[model samples]
Target: MSVRTLPLVFINLGGEMLYILDQRLRAFNTSEDNSEKGVWSENDRKRVMNDIVGTLFSKSFMDELLKPQQLYSHRTMKTVLTRLAHTSIMRLNPASMDRLYELMIMAFKHQVFLCPRPKDLLLISYNHIDTIKEFVKDTPVVVNQVNETHRKIIEVYSSLSEGEFQLLRQTLLIFCQDMNIRVSLFLKIKIQNPNGRFAMTTAGPVPHGIDVPGLIRTFDSKGREVRRREFPNGGSYTSPIREGSFELHGDRVIRLGVNMYTADHPEETHTTKTPSVKPNDTPNLLAKEELNLLARLMGSVKAVNMPGAEPGFRINLFNTDQEEDEAGASAGAGESLFGVINIQAMQDEQVATELALIAGQFAEKEEESENQSANKGDELLAMMDDL
Candidate 1:
């Protein structure tokens, strides 16, 4: 038996027989001795059959492939089909027949190949019970482990008919949503739908949000350590504070980096109503106003979930001039707008363990030093005797 002459089976990824249409036919004009011509003729026939199968698989075979709805290039579809055709055992089934129709219709509409006669096509549109059972055994549908959001989406798709599934899949592709999430919800969606990048970039299995107080403590300890190391002499280099807090409650916008833009006294007095600023200028003015409003709203709260540089909160470096021994030395000088703090956002589980360890060391060391300093010579001698 020749490899070229062997009966070819057309199967989907699930190993279901879509249909058995035509035998590999040779061109009447080609000689068997002309290997190039014979090979060419055989390849051409296989390609046509592949296109027919691809069209049947698409949503509206005709509309999905031919109309503006089709996104893939005709050439791309050919490559996809050629690859799919490599699988063994085409199982006949209601699902397979339905998919074949979609693929064929799409291919025909796209003019990927000349449409074949129904007679020439030899449509084997019967359900292969054995193949169906095997397919069910071998290819069970599974939801991707990372995408929980898609689990809900698939439930909605389960009620849809095959045609509806195809249409919905196409719609998801057009709208630029996660097809994996969509497909996991609906088993009928193709296994080959492009792997979704949105999920890869944005979604993770980590808990949704973070802890506020814990995060602040972490940043504070870290900042203090860094500051102590850097400024062993105390010139007060300002480091970053918590920028703002996005909590389970809601995000709080911080206002810092303020630049005063009040009119000069003479300009204000002469104010012949400065030609009512144009709408084009309104956006910048509005942005400045909003920043100021945010500053006022957040300014003197004893504590917020987190703190850091905000748009309106400028870090001004005003100095105290009291011969280095002023009674209100800290109070006289401008306070660090972000406060004397550095806060890190606390992520979950593993991070919590790390933070706890570091914090424990610092607390323990401080306690040890304080105890040692409090005990004088006799107390130290007594403690040493007990040891």
Candidate 2:
């Protein structure tokens, strides 16, 4: 009896081949030691493989490949590739080795690993290796590759020693945060997986890591880890303060000297409550200085501060109206800017004094004239009585 051969296939295109990732499934099988429930069997895998082969050879797929989106930056290219890696539509062309190489080079060049895991494959690219080698100048390529598995692998190689592990982690975190923001634009739907592992079943639309409420609870339940130490010059440090300072969450004012503690602390301490401000008081003195900015906009400050004018210097001018019946009072002059501002409005005392003096002189002259007229009228009346 002749033995039937189950065609053994290895699409050896350095990291771009994801659709036919039977090898990853095999690795998972070896590690898990149990077949995932609902997982495709060997026969199903063969069928899917045949479907993939069909699409790769099809003219439609080739058209789409030729009409790739025009992307400006390496970051944008990475986003495009990451989306493609997650998509199930693209059929893997096993025979087109050149095309496969092109895809792999594109993926590796752009740090596509920062994206979510590719389905059915554990992809690693040569570009990542080159990047790692460049980052750790004196390290061997093998060591750089292994370092991904064990991040602290730098300690093992004296030639590749870095200044501090914490610094590297911080740099990596900042880099990832920035890249993630850029990548988020392309992610039409967020795919979540707990622990980045599937226990024989894919959790659809699930987020990676613990849920928000659970994470909050876990943090609340954790014990308070206090860090207190004595520094030189009788200085003391507390974990909460250090944590806040390290995180750069407090006021940014620079203090000059040792008495800086008093300078640095807000009026109210040991509470999250913002200190109550007086109706006009400002917490930031520099903010109060900004009121002077209004002066600049309005023109000279000296014009705003001239001394008040005396009421005598002021004139109460009026409009005369024809007298009607006694039922209603005549309407005084309607408020006008000229009247409100020049006659009635407050002004310098010297200007007011001059105005009052002028009005008094006019009153005296009118009184003298009335007296002269009355004397003339009495003389005329006496002449008439004598006659």
Candidate 3:
């Protein structure tokens, strides 16, 4: 997948693929899995995403966009990672951490995992004056809020490795705690199964781990074990697997990067959550839907930073209009699960201060060079006068 440019603004792409997805979903609904509770496959990630989108964007939502609607980095994703931990995710494509660390070590740079070229930082925010004026100063209420925020942060902080701990403290925290933020931390996970096997079967009411022959172990979105019963001594040893990511939208978590198929009615009906089609739903929608459907046929997935990530994290899903309203109150200027970033939404003073500092450094260097030039000029004048 092309690693699209960063500073990706979240926008909905509509059209024919939406219809294809709708159609594919209809087929899936009638599939055998729907009739019974089956062990989740890597494909379950798609189901999770469909469930999430369907839940969020009800039939008429686009005409009436959901409350607290915000943009996504990109709805289209390449890979869905099944196993993740509390670590920094570069907006850029996945790269070797060891290699980046080596480069940083050689350069004697403190931030090991940061985008090496500072200019590559699509957007960086300095703290707003309010951080000092409104948040950090002696106001009792603000002070309490600051402490509460920091306290929660520290909890996540403790669970990290030394390198990650430093990165969070130095880089991610400054952006996350206040409105002047830049990035968010991410927790990756895998498919979940209670039993250690991947091919599982339930002979009776209870789900059981089968030991037929060659079974694999896996995890789910929340990192619970994906137990499976052993496959019969099969011809081919490998089963092609799929992957996914648990995407964060504000405080709510949804699954994304799901190349799965569950159909939506191309045309909206009042009976279900399938969103109403608008004129803008373009032709390319078919390609989009087919791609996702193919991924589902293929199946896999992968968090939040609530720390203590030994076994896995616990996730709870609930949506209420009242909660969304409350969310608006707390959401940052550009809130993200990776980290809260203020983006360029900072106060003028912060920006000016940064520019001033850069200008000052250049001015000092220029002055020093001019002084050297003047000294050389005087020496040449003395030589000429002597001649």
Candidate 4:
């Protein structure tokens, strides 16, 4: 017998048959491939997954997605059909047929993609069967929570339709499995109408670490942690406490750096109202009124989550004397900011054991030196005993 052409089967988590239709020919075929003949393995599956990602989320696709609402009626469905030509199974269901149509409509209608707030928080976890939570009354959806005092807002994320959600859930599972940061991460999600949603129906088991958003921490005006300003170092620095928080990374210590603007004299009224300076003129080019406003408005934007930067209350160094360095007119002063790190675990069992050993040594020394006991300083003895 000539090499038997492969017959392919498309199935979902529910064992439902998936088919690709060629309406013109009115023919259906489930072309099984050499996958059953040991050609497809874990690594091969990974390669296929990568190919799906590269093709679907390519830069060109993303750019088109940004303006997805534009009608694509003129463009022939040939391009889309060609991509789906990879699969073949004659027995397709109405769900499968409608699913394909729905996705196409979404792409043509500009509902294919979204840009979520706090960009990095891309995905969230939720029960697959969890029905959308509805409010008691049809109220306006508040996409983000704002803090009036600190002007901080909790990040809002995007939700997906059933089809897009399922696809993403599958793709992300593949993507995260091979990544170094394979730990499951929860994220915020926004819900929109389908192509409702899609996922592995009978395609076997659904992988972990992908879903819609669940219980999230809500923040109010008093909540300050979520609003830490990121400070970019090694560049020209602006003098606005509104300039936000300095970026602290790597193995560097957190230090306080402040500068005063002399030209800005809110304490002394300006004889003539100064015009706004060119942004290039100087970093500290605020008018006296603006300067006073900035100083008053510099309501310490503290970091909510970042360690060592939470006590991050803003200060106007201009009003206070600059703690000059050993070398006058140097870059800036570096004083360590305290209470940023949680070191409770640092005093572990080993630390307690070490302290006990030291105290024992001190007690023995005190006994050996009888005459020295007469000179036992209360402060030193108390310190040793405490240790």
lDDT of 4 by residue, 21-119 (tens): 111111211234324332233333333323332332233332232331211111112222223222211112222332333222222111112111112
In candidate 2, position 296 carries an lDDT of 35
**Model 4, C-alpha of 63: deviation from truth (Å):** 1.7
For model 3, residues 1-387, the per-residue Cα lDDT tens digits are 111111111111111122222333343343434343422222432433333233222222222222222211111212111111011111111222111111211111112112222221211111111122221243354344334433433343245454543432344323212211111111111111222111212221111222233567778999999775655554422321222112223454422211122223212210111122222223344335544543453232222223653222112111233543443443332123334447675579988899999999987885565444333323322222222
Point out the worst 10-residue segment of candidate 1 by lDDT.
1-10
- Stretches of model 2 off by over 4 angstroms after superposition: 1-20, 28-36, 67-69, 72-107, 110-387
Q: On residues 1-387, what C-alpha lDDT tens digit does candidate 1 reach at each position?
A: 111100011112111212222221221213434255213243343443343343333222212122222232122222233323322122122222323333332222211111111111111111121222322232222112112212322343344464543443343233222112212211122212233121111111122232211122223644563322221322222322333211111232111111101212111111011222223222233334433443343233223224762211111011122321332343234233224457878589998999899999987885564333222212212222222
* Candidate 1, residue 99: lDDT: 30
lDDT of 2 by residue, 1-387 (tens): 001000000111212243214332222222232254433344433333333333222233322222212211222223223223222222222122222223333222222222222210112222222332332344344343334423322222223223332332233233232221111101111211222211122222122331212112122346764443433422222223111111111342211100111212221111011132223221333322332332233233133236672111100001111211111131122112123235577799999999999999987885565444333323322222222
RMSD (CA, Å), each prediction: 36.7, 39.3, 29.0, 33.4
TM for every model, in the order presented, reads 0.16, 0.18, 0.16, 0.17
Q: Which sequence of candidate numbers ranks them by TM-score, best first?
A: 2, 4, 3, 1
Ordered from best to worst lDDT, the candidate numbers read 3, 2, 1, 4
